[model samples]
Target: MREIFEAELQQLGDGLVDMSRLVESAIGRAGTALLEADHQLAQDVIASDHEIDRLERELDERCVHLLAQQAPVATDLRIVITALRISATLERMGDLARHVAEVARGRYPGQAVAPAARDTFVRMHDAAVHVAGRTTELLQTRDVHLAAEVEKDDDALDALHQETFAAMLAPGWTGTPQETIDVTLLGRYYERFGDHAVSVARRITFLVTGDFDSEHAPSHRAEV
Candidate 1:
């Protein structure tokens, strides 16, 4: 019975790794779709989000079953509960990627980001993608150091998000109202994407160290 329970725990960890990989792919493709105006790719990213959702539901069900049947205690209990939380966070990250793709799809033939803010959006995209990749690595390796790198990547994304607002407020800004709206929304989508990634990182860090940094709690509200 103990061996079987241990195997179940391993399966839960593997499920998280799988979900993180899907999220990483979603954001990378979504960024490409946004920059290149590839309507087909945007549609693909939107469709793939369902798989992430399905995985989350399935993983959560497994966690619940383990809790009911195995009655995990102490560290084992923490593992199951943390898996549930991490799966939920990954699902939200997947949703943010889909939202980015949705914006791209809404704009269709025209690019979502305006010419002046294109460079900033590009940097945001790169940072977001980097953070997503790091998140996947962190989940797989459980290396707390990778969590710190994820935080740094999110900081870069935050700075780029601010740059978008500064461009819109500049005296020489020439974007139409519609363009301004697109820039604002896209910047927010990318910023929120990074925020969710940070949440995942902090959660993994907590699981590894068995200690939550009061300054960097796993709560998304605290991070945002």
Candidate 2:
């Protein structure tokens, strides 16, 4: 019974890694579609959302099944609960990416961001991609150091989000009202994407070390 339970736990971890990989691809492609106004890519991203949702549901059901059958205790219990939280976080991240793609699709055949604000949007995309990639790494390796790095990427995203807003409000800004709205929404989607990535990294840190503070926690130690 113990052996079977351990196998189930390993399977849970594998599912998380797979889900993170899918989200990483989604955000990367979503950013590309947004930048280029590629209708087909945007459509792809939007359609892929169903798969993310499916994974989330499957993970949730697995967690429930484990609790009912394995009756995990102490650290094992924590891991199961944390997996549920991380799955929800990843699902939200997927939604944010889809939202970005939707913005691109809505403005198909025309760039979503205006010329003057393109640089800021591009920077936002880069930061988002970095955060998403780091999130996948942290999930697979459980490397606490990657969690701190993910937080740093989130900070970069926050700065870029502010800069985007600043540009929209700058003097003599000439973008049409609709264009301004698209840029605003795009900035929000990218910012939220970073936020969700950071949340996942922190949850992984908690899962590994039972310590929520990634910065102060010793990298080499985990209570489990």
> Which candidate has the highest lDDT of all?
1
Over 4 Å off in model 1, which ranges? 214-224
lDDT of 1 at 47: 97
Best by TM-score: 1
lDDT of 2 by residue, 1-224 (tens): 98988999888888998888889899999999989989999999999998999999999999999999989999899899889988998998899899999999998899988998999888888888888889888988999899889989988888888898888899968999988999888888877787777778878888888875652344321111
lDDT of each: 0.90, 0.86
Candidate 1 lDDT over 1-224, as tens digits, reads 99999999889999999999999999999999999999999999999999999999999999999999999899889889989998998998899899989999998899888899999988998999899999999989999899899989988998898999999999989999988998998888888888888888877877788785832664433244
Cα-based TM-score, every candidate? 0.95, 0.93
Cα error, residue 196 of model 1, in Å, equals 1.1
- Cα deviation at 119, candidate 2, in Å, is 0.7
Model 2: lDDT of residue 102: 94
Error of 2 at 166 (Å): 0.8
